[model samples]
Target: MKALLSLALLLTWLGRCTGAAQVFMEPQLRARAGDSVLLQCLFLDPDSKGWTLHKVDWLHRAGAGTQEEMVFFYYSNHGVPAGRFKHRVQWRGNISRWDGSILLQDLRLNDSGTYECELRLLETSSVFMRCEGSAAQVWGASLLLPSSVTACVPSAPKPPGLCQQRGQPGPGAC
Candidate 1:
């Protein structure tokens, strides 16, 4: 009987740990060249400890391989843009509530493709301490092609914005 009761408690604990605390992106958004977009993120946690958002970014898969590059960084209070991504992206969410939504203005042909909105959170405790969650991954932030762009048309050369050397965080890497 004791063993069965213990198993029940363990299952309950596991359920909470893997519960809805996960972060997710709304959907793949598309914008015309020189247009703007609103990146949305939802934090599905019910606990009142609140959330502290950190290290929000937008990544684009460069070339024909699987790896991607970081075009924007949203930490340290400044949305530092890579030399190329400058004047192209901005954060649209409220900094205080962990709304990590971002805004990207002026979509270029080089911007057409799959883009992902990456984000992190710091959950506070009753002891006045904080705990950070793993980086969440969402797929399919596709750039919609304007009627002007042909299927055979290759986008312009992307400004070199790689994430590898930038000390950027990865999904579950934090």
Candidate 2:
């Protein structure tokens, strides 16, 4: 018997650059093998005008203390998904709206790790100051919103209390 326990993630705005863009993310997720999950990330840009994006990168770590690798990257109009995520991930957010979210499909046991979303602007020479809640700096060009999921595969006979229990605001297919 196995159990899949899903927990919520924390979102903290850690910057002080008067008008620089900041990121906000939903909680982490939990699901079973063959399920799909959405990693949400939204950026709030002080400037009402649409901001130009240089690149959007999605990184993943196999587990705690493991090295992070590229899951997907978007530049210009082309997106490249790497490694095991080559055909299982999708970019479902619009950068013009400051959204950098993604949809991860075909969940696998080894995919149990931390996923991070980073957004870099095309304009780097300009010094922007964003002071919402506290920060947003030149050093803050990259936003890190990492979400993780814990999953499991049921053994034969499917013992009681071994099923995954997830609710509200998550993938309904689980």
Candidate 3:
């Protein structure tokens, strides 16, 4: 009986050391340009048996057939978004709560792409278990006008040399 008890105890301990947490995220989202999108990412800790949050990486892939870019990261501290996401992405979830969600603000048409939330957990055996989930975003018909663009609203008067005739070769049609 003592041998059987020891075997059972060993099995339980081994299971705890090899367990990995699972990540969850929305599958798809449809939004309009110039809007904010909250990419929800939550994880399961399984009663905190032996897993601890190590790192969280937020990745984005522009359109299709493109490489994913790590837009943000959290390592029990904070992450500063860089490059095109410098002033756009915001990490709104807490690692302690097993939430890795991020809020994508001031979204433009170019922001329509696939986003991934990756989580790394340290197991009881000092090994790392990686979990990742992704979601695809579709943006509505719209444009992000830059400072150099003189595009006018339908109600506004067309600017000089800005609006060209439909058949003429110039900028955009009024």
Candidate 4:
């Protein structure tokens, strides 16, 4: 029985670890012009505790645009771009099993186009590296945020007491 168990384990490892590590997308889906879709990415490796997902990036190409820049990027709440997806994206992979998938909320029509998730990992020797895979044609409308919300966002928060200082002085005068 011990020999049989060992054989089973070996076959399982071979099946999941046989080929080059790659990212896979799910749902076999489609979305309309104003719909939001969640794209999931997985890295497969039977051996080891799964590939380390150091980072995930999204890219887009709208109409004739020549491969536009990164839509959003994240690593420990940092490296996020000031774009349409600035605060609408979140990643929950750091908590368990190191899943690199990201969840995007309130997706817009402009969010359409080809998207890619970039994965970075350490090889067997602990060497750092990165790999990227693309999302299928995401058909949606041109990217645009509501004028009211856009106007409310400031470049940065006002320093503490700055607002109070505007209408008063020395903190003692009326």
Best by lDDT: 2
Give the better candidate number (1 or 2) by TM-score: 2
* Global lDDT of each candidate: 0.40, 0.52, 0.48, 0.39
**Residue 161 lDDT, candidate 4, scale 0-100:** 47
Of the pair 3 and 4, which is ahead by TM-score?
3
Top TM-score hit: 2
lDDT (tens digit, per residue) of candidate 1 on 101-131: 5566665555543444555444522211111
lDDT of 2 by residue, 1-174 (tens): 122424244443332333334444333345545767766566554344455755667777665578988888777877787988999998877766655667778765566555566566676633222111111111112433233542111123332322232222333332
Q: What is the C-alpha RMSD of each candidate to the true structure, in Å?
A: 19.3, 14.6, 24.5, 21.7
Show pairs that collide, candidate 1: 33-107, 34-107
Model 2 quality (TM-score): 0.60
List candidate 3 stretches off by more than 4 Å. 1-21, 123-174
How many collisions per candidate? 2, 16, 0, 2
Worst 10 residues of 4 by lDDT: 2-11
Query: Which of 3 and 4 is ahead in lDDT?
Result: 3
Candidate 4 Cα outliers beyond 4 Å, as residue runs: 1-20, 32-35, 46-51, 63-65, 76-82, 123-174
**lDDT, candidate 3, 1-174, per-residue tens:** 000000000000212233333333222234445666666556544444555776777776664577877677777587667568878988787778767777777766565444555566654233232333233323233422221000000112333343332233554544
Q: Native-vs-model 2 lDDT?
A: 0.52
List the candidate 1 regions with Cα displacement exceeding 4 Å: 1-17, 22-30, 46-51, 63-67, 122-174
